[model samples]
Every structure is written in C-alpha cells, then in structure tokens.
Target: MTDTAQYQHFNVFLAHEDHKSEPYHKYLKASANYETYELKSSLEVDGILYVKVPKTSQPTWAKFAKSLTNSSIDELQNNSSSAVLIIRAPKATMAVTFGYGRHLLDMECFVTDFGIKTALNTLNHDTLRSVDVITLDEQGVQKKSQASRSSNVGVFGIDISKDLLRGVTGSSKAGVGLFNISGSGTTFSFGKKIKVKDMPALVERIYSYYQSNDYKDSFAWVDNIRRLEEKKDIEPLNKKLIDEISKTNPNIVISIPEMLDWDTITGFSFTRTKRNIKPTIDSSDYYSSLDKDNLSIDSLKRDRLFVFDSSDEDPEYKLYDCLYFEIKGSEKTYILFSGTWYEIADSFVETINKLLAEIDITSLEFPEVYTWQETSGKGKVVEKIETEGDYNERAALEKNYYVLDKKLVKSSRTTTSIELCDLLTKDQQFIHVKHRKGGSAGLSHLFAQGNVAAEIMLGDRKFRVAARSVIRNKVSKDIVETVPLEKLDSTKVEIVFLILGENSSTLKGNLPFFSKVNLTKAYENLRQKGFKVTIGGVDKVVKPMP
Candidate 1:
C-alpha cells in the first residue's frame, strides 16, 4: 500500500459492549483521521482495529481474539505494516491473551485499564493522558512504555518493566534466571522458572512492595527463596510471610482452634442448631447482636495489637466470631485469629505447634461464649466523636497555612455527617487530622475514617455538591475568598492522613509498619479510582502543640 493510500484507507474496528461503545465511537469520530468499521459476520478489508473489552468480559474477548486467527475472514487482513489490538481489562488473563494473540496474529497490542484513551492517544498523538500503559513488542513481550525497547529480562515470557526490574536489581542491565541480586554483587539462583499464570500476581506483589518503599524486604524475599535451597531456617520463612501480610489492609490473623487429643467432639446443641437455620435470622444480624451482649468482653480484649468487632465487620464477611490470640516469639508478637492467615506473626508456626503439643487434656471443654441478646441495651457502638485535640490540630493547620480549611462542611437540608477530615483546600486536598495519646492502633481508626471520607468525596456526587455548597457558605468570606467546584472530581481529590503526637520517636519507628501498609493500600485503591493519596505524621504537617 502506498504511504498516502495507507493513511487514507486506515480502518478502525470497535468491539465493545453496547453501553461502552458510544464513547469509543465518539472519540474515534472526533479524531477525523481514520475510517471506522463495525464487527460483521463476514469481512472484506483490513486496517487498524481497536478492541475495547470490559474486565468482566475478558475471557470472551480472549476467545474472540483466538478465533480471529483460525477464521477465514478475508477482511481481517492488515494492509498496513502492523495491525493494532488494544485490550483494556484489569484481569491478568486478558493481558496474557493479548500478549499471546499479538504473537499468533503478528499484531502489536496495547493492554491497559485506561481503555480507549491510551489507544486514541497513541494512534492520533492526542494530548490526552493515561496513568499507565503496556504494549507488546514484535517478540510478544510486554513493555511498560513505548520507550522500553530492550527485551533481555522477562519473567515467564512476560517482559518485566524497567522500573520493576531496576527496583529489584538497582541497575539497568541484569541477568535473568533463578537468582537473587544483592547489594554486594551476589547472585543466588533457585533454578526453577516461575509459571506464566503465577507471574502477574508475583510481579504485582513485588512491584507493590517496591513501590511502597519496602525494597529491603522485596530484595530479602528473593534472597530467602534461594536460601531455602541451602537451609530450612524458620527465621527467613517467618520474615518472608510477615512481609507479605504487611501489605494487606485491616490486618489478618490466622489461628487453628486448640483441641485436646482425648476430648470428644460434639455437634452444636439443638438451640444453637435452631439459631443457625432460622429463617428470620440474618447471620450478620445475629452476630452483631451477639457483639452487643459481649461488649464488655470485647472492650477488655481490645489491646494495642489489633482491633476486632465482636461481630464480622469486614465487608467481604471473611472475619467472623473468632477470639484473638497474641503469639509471642523471638522476632515479633503476631496477633492470631481464625479468619485470615495474612498477619500471623513470625515464629508462630514453630511456637504454636510446640504449644499445641503441650496442651493439657483436662482443660479441654466447650468454652462458654456470649450470644446475641435482642433486648441488650449495651451495644458496641463506638461513635467517632470529634474531640478538642482534633479542633486544636485543625486550628494549628488553618492558622499556620493559607491554602487550606479546618472543617469540610457537607451541607444538607436536614443534616450533615460531620466529616472527621479537618483540612480541605480548593485545590482538592483532603486532610484528616488525628491526635491520639496512645499507640499506632488509634491511628488505624484515623486511617479508616480518612479512607471513608476520601471514598465519599470520590464516589458520592450528592456529597460533592453539598461539600461545594458548604464550602461556599462557611469559608467563602472568613476562611477563604471562594471555593471553586471545578477541580473537585475523583482525579483531583488528594487524601492526607495526618497524625499529630508528642512521641516522634515511637511514631516514626512504628508508623511505617503499622500505618504505612494500610495507608499504602488505601492510596493504591484511591489511585485506581483516579484520586491521589498519601500518609504521614505531624512533622510532615505542622509542629505538635504542647
């Protein structure tokens, strides 16, 4: 095809759901550069085809891509030098399929969650921007950006990004194999290749750690795998697991119920069995009611180690009615529960196993546990009341700074949920101020509240309008001149969890592990929704008032 004709005859095919196809068409139509084609039973001509698939329909999309290779469709032919396939999905399977299909069809593919924006930007050289974009080279290897040309290093055929590889190796050029790249120019290889299916999760896990400023542990994890070949030490294993668990939010504690060898196990009593199968009983309602009855015990059990709702508070319903256990070992005291296996302390496996062996037979019995009472007055309702300390911190920030406000008032006709977040700016900065005399556990509540407010700001449009209205009413004259509502979308919202305290030493040392992980996860979650997120202490903000 002639150069001029190639440009003239460029065709775009859109494969998307009926609801999502309009935007793709609209953007393509606005480009005014290429001819668009619709998917048909039979085809006649070939050009650059753009495929937009939702994350839920990735499997079907993959199958469709595979079908194109074997089909006898004459229109599927590419007149240009290369055909383009864009797969927009969050699932790793779609990415793998895109990579595989690129090789099979001799087409260049771009994989992203940003969808048609990235595709249109690349094809038309439009000024539109996207967060992250991945493209496959001629060899079917994934590239983070178009600038990444080298393909020497890859895990399980999926090319590793330079940032990820550099974070692991701390260098541009590094050998690929089963090995640990260390600081002192040391390499230890495990001699086993990671499976292709497992590479996505592994890469994401490592890259998240690398991104979270936990590079030391990321490197140690790779090194520990090699160490497994030489020796079976529990220390490295414990460290490796603990590091993995730390990245997750809300903390996970895993435990196995202790039972004596001689004790006879019995099924639930008739009353208990009736409660379980009752048509009127919602499991959550029953559990929550139980929590109210056990409020005293729950308060007594609440320590600096971990927080548990007497009932299952986790959105996923993974956490249930399980008592917490503090497993103290040489390294760290890990809190254990029955629901999640993520945050179990290091040395727990060895120590717990030993403890289980020494359990007395006489102590074995069906333990007395609190059940939900319908008429219980003492409910476990820990209302988050804003304190004087919170007001003081807000005053300090507002008095010291010009660009922010203390209270982000969300106005309604009847009522407004007083957002714990104190400082908000017209530039879309959302700051939550927390002043606690206790340990990092208090900071968790702050983080949780901050995250919730951030979510509301990002998702709830009613709140957004109300917030803008409140800003105009409250701060337009006194706090600031006026509040602009233009830059207040998800992309513009920036969440800051600011913890104020006198004990800087303790906060600094424990904050990174205790608060940083949850905050980082929150940051990531918000970032995925196009909002910016950050976590820090009083030092990053203003000085703590004496």
Candidate 2:
C-alpha cells in the first residue's frame, strides 16, 4: 500500500460481460451532467457529479413550529454527490462508485445481482450486522423483510426473520458497501467511505472488488441459501414462464387465481371493449375475448380483458389483472397472479399437485344456481340475497338428498358443533362444498374445516349420532332415517369437496398454491382413515335472479 493511501468507502459495479469494452458514454445515462477528473493513473475515466436541487416541500414539523408566535426556519437545501471511477481491465471494465452515481448512468449498464454475489463471496456472515429475507409462494403469498438482529447480532425490527438473504451489512476484511448493505441493491462496494488522498489506492480497490465478485462462494452460511432464488428475481423467471408455456403439453394453464363473483362475471373476454360477448364461466377464455388470433403475454398486458356488467357494458374489473399462470422452474415454481410474480418451493408445489391429482374430481352436477340478491323480498328490495349454501341446501332437499348444510353436530368434548358436511348423498357421499376464491389464504379455512369434519366423522361416534339426529329433526325428507349412524364404516364413506364449476380441470388450475398444500395434508389424513376423498367440480344450474 502507498504511504499516502487513505481509507475511503466506495461501492463497486461491474459492467456486463458483453459491454466490458464499451465507451464511457455508453456506460453513463444519456445527458448525464458529470465533470471529468484527471488522475493520470491507469484508469480509463474518473467522473464526479454534484447535485444541488431545491427541497420538494418543507417538513410538517417545520410548518407547525413556524406557526408559533416566534420561530425561525431556514429550510436546508439538498446537496448530494456521486462519483464513478472506472478502469478497463482484461475482459472486463470495473467501476469504483459512491453514492447515487449510478442514477447518472444507464440503469442496466452494469451486471445484475453482481453486488450481492460479491458480498456473499467476500464478507464474513457470522459477524454480519444485518440480513434481508423474503418469501414467495405459488399461491401469490409473499413476504419480504430485513433484520438487523442476528441470533448473536442485535435485530432492529421486531418479528423480522430471513426468507431470502437480500443484503448484509457488517465488517469485512475486504470492506463493505455503503452502510454495509451488499448484493441485493444497486451497488456492490468495498472499503469504508472516507477522504482518499492516494489515487492508486482507489484504483487498486476497484480490481480487488472485482476479484471479490469473481471469487467462488466461500461463506458457508450465506452460500447455503444461494440455491434459492431471490424474491426480487422477476424478469428471468418471467422469460422462463414464457418459454415453458410455449412447450407442447406444458402442465400449466391460465387460472382464475382468486375467488371472483362468477354470478356477476357471466363470461370473460380478452379484449376490454367488446359487444354482446358470450359469457363463459372459465377464465381460460381469456384467449377467446373476441380477438383470439393473437394470444401472448404482450396481448394480455396490452388488451387487458374486462368483465362486463350484466348488460355487457359499464364494467371494468380487468380480467387480465385477475388471471394467474403457474410454471415450474428447474429449482423453484413460479406463479404470475393478479399481475404480480411469486415463487414457491418446487417441492411444495409438486407434492401438492401430485396429492391433488390422486383425489379424483368428479364433474359437479347442479342446476344453474347462484348467490342471488332478491330485489323484491319481504321489506326493502335487495339485489341478490340467496347464498351459495342456501342454494345448495334447498337443491339437496328438493332432490330428496340428505341436507346437512348448516346442521351442526355438537362436539361433546369442546362444546362446539361441527357441520359434518354440506350435503350427504344417498350413495354414501359426504359432500363439503364452498363458494370461495381469492387465493390459498381464503381456501385454507375451507380445507381446515373439511379436514376437521372428516376426522370427526370417522373417530367421533357421538358426533355421528348428533349429525343423523339433526338431519332427522330439521329435514323433511324421509331419507334422513337412512343417514349413516349407530354403525359407521370408514371405507364406505366418501368425502368430496364439491366445487360449483364445469370440471376438475378448472379447480386444478384455479385453486391457490397453498390451498393445494392444505388439500394434500387433508387428503393424506383422510386417506389414512380409510375414506375415499375426491374433489368434485360440479355443474351449477343457473336461474335468472329472482
């Protein structure tokens, strides 16, 4: 080291391998105001920028203080600076940067995730001050957070844990980025910030930072989770989705992602502007939105589909916005739902899909039924009032089906009554049905309810007695006497999740990712109890709103 060398903090940015030899102008953003510096060193270019902009607005506290009888407020102006020091090396161009210098450069001029890779390679994880973590699942369930508290290091925010290691800040022999944040942000840096007296030292730091980036992962703990994709990884996964779906027989399909009001959404169209369009219950019809010729992601974004009002006009629930598509990557599975991207553990998605496939889904058969808002009821006029459960219960009774939709079986143990199933068929099928959407979060409760009911049906004999008695007491159908009681055979009982849809294919695609995980657990638990479990995507009979 030079005797005149001084310590300084600087972030490092590595140019994309392809653009290593590009001119400095190509590296900077267009019309960037920067002054050149003459170092007379082996550096290609040394540029610095000082920005002086007026504050957008005064602080609220400043205004309130000035409102006092006597107060003085000299608003401070904003003064910030950034520097870009670049050196052309063999096969690559490395830049020693500080502050928001990159704001003055082409956003994509540098390599992607180079900072994080370098930090993981260079820094010591054990003594690191903080780490950022994020989690995303195929269900569109997502969470991103940062923690200053290590089990050993103090954590800053409460309830913060690592899901994806985005940034790390702490002391390192190779130095750290500004404020110690690395990898997950715009810049990868080395050395602490300070006045630089020696030009040679800063130039050397650039090469060392590059070396730190090229070095293989040596931090055992940090490298352990590198196999997982960062939550912020979007474009690459999106391209992967496009590629995977382009393949023949891709196990992916367009789904409704959330529980939408099917009653209002008579059908869907890809083109937002269409007249007298036929309403289809399925979401896959996004292609058939009257402009079926061009079905691509670009089209989905450009010609966002809209759900129409009952008269096929004056509605703007963007269909494109609600659509969800799932794809499995090499290591993780990703989903694009409600216009956001999320990734799930490939193992979780695959396991759930496999388990879901095991439970045969029979086509649900029912009249065109829906949640109706009766406009001419007893008192004030309501729009649509009959709930899905009410429809199911009434339909089951009319057909002489053993109706148990709301008949609660009191649990002698917990003083709680559990609904055995929505409707029980004479053929020994105990059906549990839900009119639900949104995502896994919404369906989780339904799955939990079904699982608990299934367990109680098989193990709790007292509950079974109460279940049959409730039907016999509340139901007018004589078939209530035939309801299984006194002696129960688990093998003979069939537990079905009746979904009001055209077929199982819809459920397979539309069901949320985490809901499928819960379904898998429920299926296994029920299967172990010697019962046949299935998902029924039944046909719903539609009647014009009464």
Candidate 3:
C-alpha cells in the first residue's frame, strides 16, 4: 500500500439505510493514502467525514442531507478541530445536498458525483495523480479548467456560477475579457486597464470580500424567509380617494365620501399658489378671504401649504375649525384656524389644586421655554420668545463663503427666506449647503433637499419673485440699484452642492468608500435632471490661509 502520510488525511462516515451499495467503501479502501473509518453513532471525528448516500432519488437524498444538519452535525463541528464532510451521492442528489449543507452548517463541506467517478477512474490510468485534494482548510480547493472555443468559459477551484459571472459582466462578450482560463489557474481581470501582474491580488481581494460575508449570502436560509415575506398579501393605500381629495380645494367644502367617513377623523389637503399677499395685512385674514372667494386650488404649483380639518362639529369642545398651515421662510405658524389668528404664546400662573384620585405625577416633566428680561427696572418681568436657534445659519454661511464668494447680501432673517439656497449669484448660481457630522448620514436627504429647492425655485413664480427681491437687495449695494431683469429668471440657474465635513472621519467611519460611491451616483442623478451641478467637499473648498 502507498504511504498514507504523503497524501491528504480524511475520516470517512458512511450513512446508508442498508449495505446494498458500498462502491464508496471499495473506492476509499483502494486509495491507500486515505485512513477510512465507519461512523457508528457519534459524529465526533478526528479527520474529514465522507457521508456516502445510497444511489437513490434526488428528493430522498435531499431529505437525508437535511436530517444530518441537526444538533449532532453541529456538535461534531464544535468538538472536532478539522472536521469536514464530503457528501458523495448521485448528480441531482449531490446538488441538493450541497445547497442545504452550505445554508445550514458552518462546517467545511462539499458534494460531488464527479469527484467519486474521477476517483474510480484512477484505477485504469496508472499515470493519473490527484492534482488538488479537498482539505479541511477554510479556503476551498481551486481547480483550473480549459477554455472552450465556444463563448462559455470554465473556471475551476473558484465556485463562481455561470449565472453570477454573466450578471457581473452584463454581457457574454465582456465575460471573456474579465475571466481567462489558463493551464496554471483561472485568471480574473477587474477592468480593461488592469495589469496582468495585479490579477492575482484582485482575485484574492474578491475572494476575501465574499468570504468575509460583507454581502448577503445567496444560499442563506434568510433568502427563503424573505421570499415568503414577499409572497404575503400586503394591502396598498387607496390612491383613488387620495388623488380626488388632493386635487379638491380646502375652501370649496366638498362633501366627504361615505366610504371614508369615520368618528374623530381628520383629512388634510395641500396646494401651492402664486397668490400675492401684502405684508401689512394679517396673514390669517388674507388666507380666510381666499376661502370665501371660492378659488380653485392647484396641487401642481410650488411652495405648498397644508390645510387640515377634523370631523368634530361641537363648537364648545372643538380645538380648531380648519388649520391653515403656512411655513414662511423658517417660521412655522398656523396663520388661520376657525376665523381666529393663531399666535404662539406662553402663560404661567400659580395654581392651587387638590388630587381627585391618586396620580403618577412623578413621571411628568415640565417643558423648557425661552424667556428674556422685559425691562431693566426692579419690577422687570420675563418675556418668552416663540422660537429659538438659527438652524439655517451654518448652511447660509457655507453657501455665502464657498459658492457665491460672499457676493450676495443677506436676505430676510426668517427660516423660509433662504432655507433652500443661501445665495443667488450674478451668474445665476443656486447654492445648497449640507453639513453632516456623523457616519450614518444618508446622501438621499442631501439629494432630495437640493432637488426640491431647484424644483420650487424654477416652477413657483411668487417664490421666484420673493427670491429675486432678496437677491436684488444684496446686489444693489455692489452693482447698480437697477439689476438686469433677465438675471432673476430661472433660465440659466446652475445648482452647486457645497458639502461640509463629508470626509470627516466621524462622518464616514469604516465604510468610507461607500460614501464616495453613493455621492457619485447622486451626482449622476442631479446631472440627469438638466441642471449643471457641481459637488465640492470640505477639503476642496477649504485651503491653507496665506
């Protein structure tokens, strides 16, 4: 017998109903290099375990494979340091077992009818030698297959399926350039410009990425769970009712649909209008007059204001009749509600109270409110401010210094004044600044903000006029008081996204490359919108002061 020490070592486990088919035993016995043993009851093995299934139907083999993936197999893997399972079955049976084993067990296992057939074929050819023996090592075996004259390319050793290769390459023609089968091994090239010497490193990187489980496993049991979830019946929202109500004017007082009528229900309608309002008149009175005029609400316009009304009719208990919500500049105020002017206020009064029943008052906490000294005298009283903090200040500063070069003047101090774009330049540049501090910041928010800002600026005439007035006021100090009217038009507005702290280590964390990839995709989308867009990170904008 050949010296067993020279060849790869494996512990064999034969799982058969009866001793009818024992070709695997004969084959293993003939190979003097392998130390074969029968697995009695315990799965604990010192070496590799070859589970030989009887020559049966595919379904039966699959059931057997699944049954073996219980606690016993797990215990075997936990106890044995170099435990491996080689499932030898029929072609169809092997495929089923291979998939199941990979999904359920972490142990290094493989299924093959070809490996057994090749081992049996070795008896005839005296010169035949085992090129690569499957081992218990985490890294799987690699084999090299010849490339055929046909477009189909075979890569041995690497378990990349043909479908996976096709999906990655996109086309069969491109597949040839990416993968080339050679005598030594299957060489993989990343791109057309990649050097031949760097192919091995690239292949190793790909292998490492896959092995690390950075991407979702195709053979994972989670896939089946996800597929089952996808098959579940999920009811969609009623779009017909939403579409009908969305287009209807809140002032028109259209009757509610019988199907939608419910107790204590509220409905909201949003509409954008180019209707001009004088700053001197009360906003509530102006909005109320629009309702009386029976003006048709156009949902397609920009700078949309939402109107909400509840079904409650009892006047004594009603909190509001109809809430006309308007967000002007940065301030959020309910300008009109049930023919009453809504002003944000605070009233503090000392109260003497007795508990009717035992209450959990310890859990309650008082809300914080901003207050300042009204007068400098001894009898000075504290006055509360409705709002606090300038959230748009940082974005405004970023836009002014980076994009416009501090050319434009400061617009209105309100939040909605320059919420979208801080500066409207002489060259028709609309600059949107986004500052992020943490790694979990999503690029989608930045994209949406910039896109919506551009959309409103271009589509809404009243908003454009207000924007022009702000820009005109700024430019009047530097240039002539009468700036060209054509400059205010949205015809040649170029959007610039000034991103601050984008490359900060705190903002990008471990997956730094993914941020760049996401940004590139966002850039492409903005460009597709017919806007001349430019993205500049903090590094590109900030330079050493000379």
Candidate 4:
C-alpha cells in the first residue's frame, strides 16, 4: 500500500451511559465549550444511519440528547466516545466520523469504564468526514488549533484528525478564502481539517520546543502547562501569556494552513522506544479495529492488535478471544495476554495452514514449541493419534481375547499391567486402550460398527429377568438384569462381548454361545457383590490401590 493509503482517521466523544440518566452531574457538566473525546475507525460511509431511542421520554431535544446518549446501541460503541459513525465505500475502504459531546472532554482520556460511550451509525456521503486532511508533523505532533479558553485544540484537533474525522479542506489562496461553513470570523488552520484562532502562541511554543535539544522534556513541560490551565481554583496566569508574546518570528505567529484534498497522499508514522528484545518462536501479534464489517484482517495481521466495541456489527473477533499470527524470518513474536506470555513457535507449516486464510502475511516462518501449564484445574491432554485404520481395524476382527494388549502409562510414567490381557492370543480378541491424563476421562466407550449405537456399559446392571417377555410389576418393570462376574456360580465362563451396536438388553439371549456383557452394569454389580470395583470403562481401568 502507498503512504496515502495508510492514513487513518479518528473521532473523540465525551459522555457515558450515565450522562443520559444523570445529565446534572458535575462530571457531565460542560466546563469547556468544545468536544475533546476521540473515536477511531476505518469504515466508509453509507446513507441511512439507524438511530435508536428509549421508549419513554419527555421532550424532543431531551429525546435527541437521549438518542445521542443511547445511540451507542448501534453497530460500534465505546466508553470513550459518544458514538462512532462509519461510512462504507465501494472499494472496501472506509471513511469514519467520530462524534464528541461539546464540552470539557480533554486530551489523554484513558479508556476507562466511566469515561464515555460511542455509538455507531450510517451517514450520506455529504455527511461523512474523510479526516484525511489532518496531518501530524514529522515529530508526531498535530498542527495547532485556534480555539481559546486554554482548550488545547491542537492536541484534540490532532487527535480528532489523526484519530477521527477525515475530508478535504477548502483552499484559501484567493483573496476570498473559501470556508465549509458560512463565516469570516471562523479561523482557519491547515485548510478544512483544523481551525486555529487561539493557538498561535501555543503553536509557537511547540515549534520552539521542536528546535530545542531536549524535546521530550519540553513536550512534557507543555503538558504541565495544560494541567495548570485545567485547574479551576487558580487565576489564569499572564506571565505565560507574556512569555509567548516575546517571540518575534512572523512564521511562528501566522498559523499557515496546509492545503490537502481528499485525494492527497498521507501515511501514518509510529515511533518506538529503543529497547531490544530477543526473538522467541511461536509468539504472534494481532491488530483489528473497533469497527466491524470494515474489519481488515490484513491490517490486523500487520498491527498485531484487535479493537472492538459494543456497537460493532459482530464483536466475535474483538476481546482478543482467538487471534492467530505468523512470524517472519528467525525473529520471534511474543503474545502477552491475560497476564501470561504464549510463544507462537509452531512449525511453519502448522502455523501457516491455520492462520494463512485469516491474514495477509509475508516472510513468516515456523515457531518452536513453548511449554505452558494451566495453574488451576487438571490440564489434560486429549489428543487423537492419527491412524491409517491400523490397530483399530485389527481389534474388531478378533474375538474371545483382550485384543488390546497394553499396559497403563501415567504422565509420570509408572506402568501397571492387567491380568488376562494376554488372553488376546487365545481367541484373537483385541482392544485399544490409553490412559486419560489431567482429568477424568468421563464416560467413554468403544464401538465395533461404522456408527456407534451400542449400549456398551452402564454403571448399574443387575435387575434383569423383570424386563423379560412380561411386565409383571411397575417398579420391577424398569429394573435391568446384571450380576457380578465373581458371584456367577456357572460351571463355565461365558464370553461376554461389548458389541458396539448392540444394546445390553437387546441381545435377548440370541446366539447364547457368546455372552453379551454390560461392562458398566457388571462393574456396578460387582461393587454391590462385595467387591471393590471402580472400572468405569475398560479403556484404561485404574485399579484401586491396595
């Protein structure tokens, strides 16, 4: 993408949900005259913004206020701004408009619950603000604003232009300067993007800071000056005003506006701290916008962070629920979330195949594995070992013997053998078994047929002979038949097979040559028959310790 294609817009708002309910509150009070809250998005405009309002209300303006307050129920919402209006374009790009309450909202409003709420809506092309006109200089600072009242419009305007609104500015070359709204007194700064009536001194001060060597500390000092302005108890200082007047440079006094049209080229510039980090494999980053439908997965893949709000069309991808990333070269990316770091070190093939469809990635490589263990519950590993129908098919063909000839291996490996396991050699019977680590394997069963519809086993088995050919008694009708293997006094041992498709009671003694077993019921019966039995399933029966 070109530099102009990368320019982003944002809008700031100033109002929370309570602003609608408690408009009289001091926090909701308008200490300043202009809006300071900012909203951000990358969506184009479409006509017909869907507006919602409360069912009961008093006045239309109050309703307007209420609608504006509650308008956040649309597609995108945040506690920072009152609402976000996104304009969808035909080319899949977007023109976003941010709305702010006209008053005391300030710069540096951290996203907090009690801050504000932004609503999402639609707008006609005429109503949309392209925000493309706003530009921060090489030092990441926006041009100065003309508003007085010590309202740092420069900061807010830069934020609003860079973070919110977008559009082309009207030119001022001719003697008759063109303005969007009707008025000669309305100050103009960088064309249509900003107005600068009161910020000439502030701009000069900022420019002086730029010329100085300790720019960082100077900028910090300017921020302190704003803090002093925000303090209502103290009288406004004339000393600072006098210091600003001493500057003799006309270039600094005359706030010359830059002309930028909607088609002007612009790009975003990010400055990073000089901190070195060793790359690790398997860590990935994700970046997404709070706007939906306009979600550019490609941008998210590049930025490595996802943004969202309540008004978003579908917030599924928001909240960092599940994000996948691909790394490039040998350098690794670390993902820090929920107070823990996860390495994105999967093999290149594995990572690419899974995340490739979701993002536009390049030069990404495979990541190495990083061990992570869950702190609370039993973290179990339930992996399906891919098979080419090898041992599974071998077990079904055998009969009369435990075809599954295996020993139990715990995570902390100490093997235990089961008796009669070698009986598989006698009748060619087979079974497959593996231990359930981390947590109880819960109720599980193996089936022989193509589909599993077998009764397999039940925890209780014994009340048989009642569900026989007749239903003699109501209470006895529901009972099933079962008996302990040890209690069976028969002269010969019946070969009880747990067929996959056959229910325990469905056999009805047919083909009595081989006994049908209800392993679940049999185990329960054995427990009732004075034997300590806890084998829920034969997969990996854990015997009770002696």
Q: Best by TM-score, which number?
A: 2
Whole-model Cα lDDT of every candidate shown, in order: 0.33, 0.57, 0.29, 0.22
The full ranking of all candidates by TM-score, starting with the best, is 2, 1, 3, 4
lDDT string, candidate 1, 1-546, tens digits: 211212111112222233222233332323223333343323222212443221222333455666757765444332322223222223211121121122222111211112222121122121111112221111112233221322222222322111111111111112222222211101111122443233334333322322232323212222111111111233343344334333423132221122111111111111122222211112232232333333332232331112222343311112222322333447554433222112233443343334323322221111111122132235522212223233444444554422233454453422547562666554555666554322233444566667776666555657666666666555444433223344445765567665543233344334422333344445556767886665444322222335
Q: Considering lDDT, where higher is better, how would the candidates rank from best to worst? A: 2, 1, 3, 4
Give model 4's TM-score versus the native structure. 0.16
lDDT of 2 by residue, 377-443 (tens): 2453332323456667676767656667777879775557778777777777777766543244345
**What's the lDDT of the predicted structure labeled candidate 3?**
0.29
Comparing 2 with 3 on lDDT, the higher-scoring candidate is: 2
477-512 in candidate 4: lDDT tens per residue? Answer: 221122222233222222222222112233222211
lDDT of 3 by residue, 1-546 (tens): 121212221212222223213343332323223233453323332122333322223443455666866544322221112222333332111111221222222111221112222122111212122222221111112332322322222222322210111111112122223221111011111223343233234333333322343123222211111100110111111122123234434321111111121112222222322132111112233234344233322211121322222454411211122222221223212122221222221110000001101111111111222123244245534222211122223333443422222333223332443344543454555555443321212333454456666665555555555545654554433423122333334334566654443332223222222233334444445555555665544421322234
lDDT at residue 413 of model 1 (Cα atoms): 27
Q: Which stretches of candidate 3 lie over 4 Å from their true place?
A: 1-104, 107-428, 440-444, 452-491, 502-511, 537-546
Higher-scoring candidate on TM-score, 1 or 3 = 1
